[model samples]
Target: MEAALIAFATTAATLSVTVVLALLEFRRRRREAVQARREQIVGRVLDTLERATRAASRAPIVGWWAPNELEYALLLPRLLAELPEQDNAVATWVARRIQHLQAATSRREQVAIGADVAAKVVQWGR
Candidate 1:
């Protein structure tokens, strides 16, 4: 009876340890997946911003429908939806970039030249 009890306890302890390790691994993988999704979302936002900037630069001031603004508007929802919690800075920066793009379009003015810098800084965290 003593030996049987000891064996049962050992098995239970080992099972508990295995369960703990599995849970830890699961948490770690979940974190990594979230991080990867965040990075991918940020990257796509950066690309859209860059493309809008380029479009604005190349677009003429006479047209009411700036292609860049249209494209950006189309992408805004997806980008906003994917933004992670506690990423207010990035969200704000993206908003500002969108505002600038729209303002430049509405005013029929030439696009700003610093879009790349803003996009890069946001993306690379530099």
Candidate 2:
């Protein structure tokens, strides 16, 4: 009976240690995943902003309007993707700018301005 009790206690201690190690590993992995995702999202937003800026700069200025269109399909997703979830003020500001850009006839010019607006949001968020 004494030997059996000793074995049981030892096994329980070992199991507890293993569980703690597993939990720590799981938390570490989750943190890594979240960090990686944030990096990816930031990269994508930066890329979009860079592309739009380049496109706008390269576009022909015609009668106070840029010739190039703002390619909503490309811009919207990346902007929304980079936008953090918790900040309603930032989100609303961005949403309003996007709405204006979407409604504008000179989308390229609008998008360039939008990038400035987005940069402000990024600054605020950080």
TM-score of each: 0.70, 0.61
**Poorest stretch of ten by lDDT in candidate 2:** 63-72
**What clash pairs does model 1 have?**
none
In candidate 2 the C-alpha lDDT for residue 37 amounts to: 62
RMSD of 2: 4.8
| lDDT at position 72, candidate 1 | 67
- The best candidate by lDDT is 1
> Global lDDT for candidate 2?
0.63
Residues 5-114, model 1: lDDT tens digits: 99999999999999999999999999888878877876676677666656555636634464755776776677667766676566666667666656653323434433
lDDT (Cα, 0-100) at 33 in candidate 2: 79
The 10 consecutive residues of candidate 1 with the worst lDDT sum are 105-114
Please tell me which predicted candidate would have the highest TM-score against the true structure.
1
* C-alpha lDDT score of every prediction, in listed order: 0.65, 0.63
